[model samples]
Target: MPSLRMFGRDWKVAVDDLAVYAGVAGLWHVVWVIVEIVFLARATAESDQPCIDSEIHLFTWYMSVDIVCFLLYALLLFYTLRGSILDVGARKPAIYILYGISAIYTFLLVINIAASVLKNQFVAPCQDAHRERLALAIFICHWIFWGVWALAALLAFDPFATTSVEQRYAARLWLLKCCSAGASEARPGAAEHIGEICDRAYSTQDEKMESSTPMSQIGALMTLVFTGVDMTTTDYATALILVRNAQRMDREDALAAGVGKPEVAPIPLDMLEDAAHYLPHALSIYGWASNVLNKQDIAAWGCGASCVAPCTGKDVHVGDNMLFSSKNMTIQGVKVMTKSNPETDLLYMSWDNEIQGLLPYYICIDRPRREVIISVRGSLSAADWMTDLLVLPVEVDANFLGCDPSSMVAPEDVKIETTASRRRLISAHKGMLGCAKTIAADLRRHKVLDAVLKSDQHAREALKHDIYKQDCSDHQLVVVGHSLGAGVAALLALHLRSVYPGTRCWAYAPPGGLMSPELSAAMRDYCTSVVCGRDLVPRLSLSNMEILARQMIECSARCKQPKVRVILHPGKKWKRDDLFKPEAEMSADARKTLEAYMRNSGSSHCAGGKVIEARDFLTPGKLLYYEANDSDIADALVFTPQFVDNKEFAKNGMLISTFAVDMHMPWMYQMAVDKALDDAHRGLPSTRVEVAKLEGTCYAPEAAAQTTQQAETDIEAAGGRPS
Candidate 1:
């Protein structure tokens, strides 16, 4: 509570302000009283007696006494309840006087208005016409004064004097506005915040300033009063505050008033822990993580804007720079610390791409937790996907898959490893960029796609060097990525596991065939994929081949009309072939078409990890979570094998929606991750979900052309010639 002593010097100022207010009101009322006295003397002289009557009793002697009585009562109440009125907790006597004045005067004003309009004279309308007019005017004016006094008295009453600054200022004005509102008001739970109101509303100047009244409250007050929301905004506001606060305090007086109730509910220990840990994490998702997607580095709430993604572009990406000293990056306002250190610095990793200039990804190391994170960005250009498209037929070379770096040797030529998963090609560009050699002039300058087909030791060595320099002394490395970046993260995480024992990766909305199930399962403990509810990207490489085939057929039809269509012939449905191994299921023509589609669209990739699916939001603004269990993602709730249920989902028009496709976007994936953290924090059960799993066998092509001749033509056509 704001104390008078806190503003010892300002007490005199407050007294002077109060005195000035009193002087003005007193002068106005005294002049009106003198007018009434002069009128009475005139009537007495005219009648030759000390008696006079008006058109109506209400506008005659009764109205004069009514005005005088309220003024006297107001003065008496101020003197008698001076300490109580200015103190907190509300004085019943002071409250009754104010409420009484407002009530009695309101009732009288209604009757007085009727009397004046009816022109009822003191004796009769004809007998005292002039006197009756003056009497009625005075009566109406007196009631108006009563109303004003009532309102002012209510706000200056006991309940407002001891509240916190916001509640104090809000006390008279809160009812006119809301919690998020300024002076023009808008809260459902306001009734409970009354006690808090009084302790804040320091009545004295020194206390008012010390109480730290927020500008929001001031705005709210101005909006209500100046905007004319109510004639007595302050009085109505104070009444609400006092009444609500009184209701809230009924708890303290419950038993004393013969009510069987306790003063407070006991705190739940588990809930306290949940609030302490989870609340910040949940809040931070919006406060820090979500802003990374906004174009600006800082929002109105003051969190750093790490997202530099151009709001208008398809390639927009957002990332944060945590190190305060980094140039051209959002400076960290608060020192992000590890458990072991009071102050800490962060690590940043950026690589240059031929198409997008320099793209920096975020890395945070929590030493006390022995964890490091590598966040990756998605493909942003035709050239970038071209890298993913120009797949090199190679397998996990056992010699290089594990630490034996000495045994690792760059491929003599981009060739198939007979023992490796050759039929399912890995993204040639991603593998090479990881090594930092895909930008070789041989490819861009000479227009030679073959030279860039292989990922050699340049990546391994650079990764090793980068890791050595970037290591924040944390042993556990966690990798996270979305869309095209998901495949890269999986590959990087599994590969690094050869050296870093605790490497784990999370891929969000990954396509199919990014990594083999054998590899995914091998790194099962180290990899997890999160697929959002029906996010078509993860399912696209599986069953959406049907959609691709249909689209192609449609495009073929459109060719006659000279309209463009993004049509690619559907390849063999991999999930169908994987399950049934039916030669009839995939005709030679279909096989060829599918291969062409995968080569061009680069859709046949899977996140090599556990896939968890999250529905964007079940209830607006409330996050939901799901658990994943599958070789391919399976929503435990809505999932059905694509081969078994794809036709039905398609028939029902529920197969693919824009929302589902958008779920593949980075922001949606981030929500899934953030929500998971929130659920885990509050100890809520994760929403169990899965999409139909993709499981089957496929005919292994014996070293399908090392590099399709068409791959070179496609890359060349898309502006990827040698620089």
Candidate 2:
């Protein structure tokens, strides 16, 4: 017998303290079962129907029993079996088994409840003996379940039970000592090293102490950062390419006016063929074997590796319909996995599109086993070429061989190759200077200030009057455009501070365009440009849109984001009586112009359609339409059209107008323009544009100034300056 005093109360157990706790826990279990039986009977009586006539009575009984059982099981498992209840490591097995049994039993109980309800749904009630017998069986099963559950719970905390507190405490102390000893053994190794390995190890340990950081986790983070930057850079490049080549009003001006140099030169077919000859031959592997990206054919080098074990054409199942070009050489293997697990075979072999011929030899390396598999996929010459060129004195590791293998090997050993000589030169030159040139070219193309001065003399005069004198320009300079105009606005605003020295510009709806890193930074510094995320016009290449449509389909297949997006805006309001034509029903000439604009911008053909909808062109939806206030598309439009009966898009809506509309809902662009004009008339002089010229015969300084002043006065009188 053992005696214990807990919280000033004295008690004695027949065996030990562990058994006392177990007995107390078991006693609660019996009470719970008895209470549950009483509830089930009470529930049946409350329903006012006999158990045989009412299946609902049975359902309530099952649910009530299970819910109580679930709570009790959680309490017993956590409070008694899970932690250092009686002992530490001593009851590990019992605790785990108890949890497993509890989980399965709970699932079984839920299933039983479901089955009973489903069966009772359509079945007719009967006053038969079978009905009463079934109801009685259900009740008995519920009681038996509780009994078994209690038995398991009691068994889980056993061995030194029925009063064994002394042994339980001793077991806990022993386990703690073992853990402390193990921890002490690990400290010395951590303090011994101080090199790169030690630094890495220390960092790893520190991270673990704070929170664990796995290598795979680190790899994913690094991958994401690099990929994001790379994608952004590539996008920038693509935009520049399209903007430079795009055949549009602004692009044409940029090119013809020589404001910006063309980014790429058209290469002759023969030259392209010649350049392709020097391309590198190497296999490209993207991730694991998801899907093959390219399927072009080329003549194979005889001694090349094949996915198949035996190198025979008879065994190869490559499609016969696949055509091989004189410039391209391809040797494909049927996808297969050597391991029992089916996912090992990912993207295995790949080549760049530039070069076409396959090399003479092939070699395969097994990563896990560290073995090499070599076979001939091409002619004997190819194999001979490889044997002569690819011989190495050292054995290669299979891991190194399979992981991003390249063609640093001998000529014969090389199977796939591509050359970036031209592209490399372009990248080296374009990397730093590209962005700057893009903006500069756009500024020259639009001659925005000059055009503004000519078209709206009063606007220019207003800018020059009070603002020019005080240099505290209150008016916001918002530059808005579609296609070329957008690019012009972006570039102008980007270089405004430097070019004009003090000017600030705001640009809206500029497409993605190339800018040098320096220029991009400068743009960020100089101006604030709002980009509508899905605007396709900015992406359109200035080249041939119709032809590029085909090219984009192929590019989209490769899943590369286009450098620029091409957005198309249908023509604004026609003459008063002109028949309205939707964009889908536009004339061929209009289509061609739109196509050309997109092609030059380097627009890619997306599967569904354009990225942004025409309705949500500028600003956000909430501000654009009053009905949008509810944030639900199901809501009806608030304002009906005043002009011609038309859809939202068919109205004379400009990107600037759309943007303004969003910012100030219920007020249209016309109202805004009227207000701006009124403000200008009240605050600033309505006439200020002046044209000054050289004074003298292009010689003496004093005479030149006097002549320039005279010319300025004459220009003012001629209405070149605001009246």
What's the lDDT for all of these models?
0.35, 0.28
lDDT for model 1: 0.35
Off by over 4 Å in 2: 1-54, 60-262, 267-271, 274-723
Q: Candidate 2 has what TM-score? A: 0.18
Error of 2 at 368 (Å): 39
Tens digit of per-residue lDDT, candidate 1, span 1-723: 012211111111111113234445556666666767655655655653222443333334544645655474555335332321112222224334434444656666666566556543344523356765666567667667767766765544543223332333344333433323233122322323322222232122344423332333243222211121111222232222332222223323443455321111112233223222222211121223333543335433221223221111122223433222232222221122112111122333343444212222344454544565555555654434433432221234543356442233334423453432222322222232332222222112221111111223353243332222333333566665555556555666666565556776666555443443334435544565545554654554322333333333222211211010101112112122121223343434334433443342312221110110000000100011132222222222221110111111222111222244555555554444445455545655443322221111110122112122322333333334322
For model 2, how does the per-residue alpha-carbon lDDT over 206-283 read when each residue is reduced to its tens digit?
Answer: 343223122212222221111111111222233223322222223234335554211111112232221121111111
Cα lDDT over the full model 2: 0.28
User: What lDDT score goes with residue 624 in model 1?
Assistant: 15
- Deviation from native of the Cα of residue 127 in model 1, angstroms: 85
